[model samples]
Target: MSHSLSMPASCRASLRTSFAMSGALVATALLLPLTAHADQQSSETPAASGETASYDTTDESPRSAYLSDWYNQNVTVIGSKDIRFGPQKIDDIYLEYEFFGRKGPLDLYGYIDMPKFFGIGNAADSGAFDGGSPIFAEIKPRLSLNELSGRDLSLGPISEWYLAANWIYDWGHNSDNRQNTLYTGLGTDIDTGSPLGMSFNFYGKYQWENYGAENENSWDGYRAQLEYNYPLASFDNGASLFYAGFTNYDFGSDLGDGDSTRTNEAVVATNAFVYSFTHLRFLAVARYFHNGGQWNDGSELNFGDGDFRVRSTGWGYYLGVGWQF
Candidate 1:
């Protein structure tokens, strides 16, 4: 009995030691990535360096400043959907959600961002614009329809190469309407947050000839941009500012009558407001995009059947507030 009792104590000691070793190994394992990110966040770009870093916080919520990325890496599948609210406008309403699983040095995730929904003013089909007007009386059912989108691996902590595309066509809610768009791209993370950590994204979108056939609006274009983020103390939220310059090269013969290359420049003012109840975040963004050699004044405004169909420069902007999980 004495010998058996001694063996149990020995086994317990071995188990305890194993657990201790396991903990130390885990802590050691976590150290590498943390150092990697700090190296980016703590310093500015070296005079000899070229680009910023690509990485987000991976620690789960209940986040603290000590947590890497400040816990921005969402292990949950969170995203949003949006649609046009009126004619002459490209935004309507949006939504978001999230999912979970964890991988090594990375978290598994998925998301969606849609920008169109149904409404009585023929939101999805017509060039219906409120024209800075107000609706006094309403008797119809305010219509609404949601859209779906897959995750954009274009920018995240654990993304490799990303590819995405979307095309939309709906005529049920209005008349003489045609619209289609396609988008896809590749990106990488550059961890240079120190002096000016910026990320690079090269994406292309093919918007078809809408309500016109002169190839007046068909083009294969890509946007190359850099973004910078800053954390402010005012709201327990981070305030990030960014600027992106985009260009599109036309493919069809419309260039014969107009410009062939289109350019867009934009600046961003942003803040992600976290809520106390549902734990969801509200993202407020303001951006201004200018289309070089593009006219948005005719029936063919941006894609309308107007005179500026040939690549000409035009300008517009949007202030949006949406949520993410």
Candidate 2:
């Protein structure tokens, strides 16, 4: 019981809502599918060659063609799904989504995994266009429920079509406490050439206690960077490839004794490689991070404003994994 109050109200509400809704949605979705077979069985579906039938059965008719087309033309639908998230990166859908297009089956096709890499062709090379530098478009719907994580609703056509974009403003009864956030940004991927993929992104990121964390913790900062990493035949199976990004960080106030680490810069360097396991479907990213900061972790540093103190340097490594559905 002591631990209950320590958790924010938003967390509790989300928990209860998810528990109730998840079960209901799953049951309703599964129920409709189960009755499909029974309906077909009760229909005038053609009987086996040797069996007697109750309804007229004709071939080469419009009705027959319709049913045949419905059955034969495969409906390959990779559905929009609900994924539950937890604290650990294992459940961080945003991070996973960010990297999924590269390793997933639609791999290199459905996702743009590179930026500023000329490994693939542009829209003009597809022969679908007869002019200089053909322009293309693609649109997608971004959906999420609840008032806290994002806007109650957002539907707009972004300028870049091959990629979908969003501007999320979430609020709720307990919103400003933990997740008092205001952010706007765009994200999307483009075709590099053909099999090669490219992803481009631009966003101004900031956070206020990230609705799920403790009340006083907040994240307010702006970061701008680009990432370029793809298959490099210059190396073995793209091993020992390089990905570099430079972005700045400006921490916010109202942190309640939290470090006033703002107006600082961070440079990103990673030498990553991939391992394929046909036995078990999983993609792992082994990245070494060289974080360049004026003040880093485990360093003797000082905050320069009126001798207010802070540390501004750090270096570390992180492991991220992606598994097939």
Candidate 3:
């Protein structure tokens, strides 16, 4: 268990909330489709005179268009360490259900995870079935401005713009530990001209029920996030390797309430390597935290047994295996 520092904020006592969605590991695939049936082959028909005639189906329309344009779902088993939630550093194994895709003009990503569900964790952890937060989930959705407006809004390297939103929830036992947060703002994808893919988002945060922190029920902060991905290699057996990562900067918060141990800014960056096939996937991530969860690094706190230095700035890691469906 983490030692507590002096604070009037109940959140600092046992904060377990996590920014799960911002750390989503999925990378979007960009498909530039010009004409829908451009790849279809022409069919041959026998004529009355026994000659063959060929006809193209390019003029034909799709029999049906699905509301969910494209999607992928997976169940992942993840082992993570030193994921800061406040003053505490969490280490646990979790089961997660993650999904991402596009539907009409909306792009989406989401996940629901059960922390410590397998009964493996540090002393600070509580199993999902053993009084811990039963579920933690985050959902992110972005509406495409170009698709909605029926116009080419592309400007040079920027391919698209979006109205984006992110929502997070942790189902703790009571109000004191539960967290609800929402971020809304703008997002955009950039065309890098090579194999690299990139996206950026800026958001204003709305805090709610944040473990009784002083910033709860208020607009407390802003976050800027950048995501990137590139394909590394491919195999003849249909397996592929890739690199993906994201960086998040959170600032402008009053959660510290004047405490030096807590601050208004935090930074988290992740680097991931993935190997994926038709039905199986594996990934490893190295994530760095600076003032993680806004808890100041190198700050001294008394865990009731004297003074201990907080190591909020460090590297954390995650290893996961998943099955795609």
Candidate 4:
């Protein structure tokens, strides 16, 4: 006795229409700030007499200013399916919400990842009730040191530097297991001036079990990540094409065993192509995950097992739409 759930055609049609309308509204909102800023800049007149205007000039370019103060605020909704290949093939659907914004000199970014399993009868009866819950939630805040110091540190391609911090929480699908992670580090934003913008970050992390005995002791680790986005083309209709990607590497000091005290735990990479239309953006993403040392041993499913034990690579794809204001 199994049951399944499927979305009705009417519901899907309604959702599509709602998204289109929302995109139009969001695009208008995003453009308003730019229009106002442009007007302000154009209206700037010479200072009266010998007096000098005290306009802020910390940011190097008008585009950067707009991004930091206005264009950075965005909300994205993504639907993705993850396929795990092993003796027991597992596939799951996830809905994700991502937000990025700025408050004064502080930049905030976060996401909620929710996993859902349809076509499964009652979740409670199938022991899959937890599928509707959030699988992970992370929030990261960064403080711009250069801006706060009231100095323009634009050297070469490097435009600004910041202090970054992250808080992450993870939950198990059907268990009380929970984990919390704290990260702090340094980061920089780079302006390539060639449609490609880059960012680099290095962080130290501390992880501990929040409610489960699965993780007995706390662990310390270090991570480095590089991210970039490039605009490929633009059309007169306000549509554009872009490429974006990120790579992350993690090293853990306490996850090793026996005589080994440090090990490379994981490396993850993602590449995406984005099609932008005014205030709406659609993205297709491809990702790869590599696990080693303690990570590979503990998360065996991620590395495969039995006949698929030799498979050490995992991949996933994502499709998403974003709205900005």
**Residue-level error in angstroms, candidate 1, position 177:** 3.6
- TM-score for all models, in order of appearance: 0.37, 0.32, 0.79, 0.63
Model 3 pairs whose backbones collide: none
- Compared with the true structure, the alpha-carbon lDDT of candidate 2 equals 0.21
Q: Which candidate model has the greater lDDT, 1 or 2? A: 1
Error of 4 at 8 (Å): 36
**Predicted model with the maximum TM-score:** 3
How do all the candidates rank in terms of lDDT, highest first? 3, 4, 1, 2
lDDT of 3 by residue, 157-220 (tens): 8887888887778888989878888999988777778756567788999988877667889999
* Residue-wise C-alpha lDDT for candidate 2, range 1-325, written one tens digit per residue: 0000011111111111100000000000000001011111323333232221112134633242112211111111111111111111111111111111111111111111111122223221211122211211111121122122433233332212112121222222243312334334443333344322223334444454443433223344444322222332222221112121212222332322343332233433222232211111112222222222222323333324333223223232223233211
On residues 1-325, what C-alpha lDDT tens digit does candidate 1 reach at each position?
Answer: 0000000111111211100000000000000011122222322322111222222224442342222331222111112222111123333332212221222222212222222222222232222232211111100000011111333443344222323222223222222234344434533333442432222334465656333423325564444433232222211122222221222232232322543232233222111222111122223222222332232222233434543322122332222232212
User: What would the TM-score be for candidate 2 when compared with the true structure?
Assistant: 0.32
Model 4 local distance difference test score: 0.43
- Candidate 4 per-residue C-alpha lDDT over 1-325 given as tens digits, one digit per residue, 9 for 90 to 100: 0000111111111211100000011110000001111111222322222111112234553332223332233445544433221112234444444444444566555545554533332222211254434455566567878879999977787777878775666665534445567779987776666545566667887766543433335646788866654446654344556555665577765554532322346665656666654345666666565642223422333223243232324765556566533
Candidate 4 stretches greater than 4 Å from native: 1-77, 81-90, 117-128, 154-156, 173-176, 210-219, 258-263, 292-294, 297-312, 322-325
Residue 266 error for model 2, in Å?
3.3
Decreasing TM-score order of the candidates: 3, 4, 1, 2
> lDDT for every model?
0.23, 0.21, 0.60, 0.43
Compute the lDDT for candidate 3. Answer: 0.60
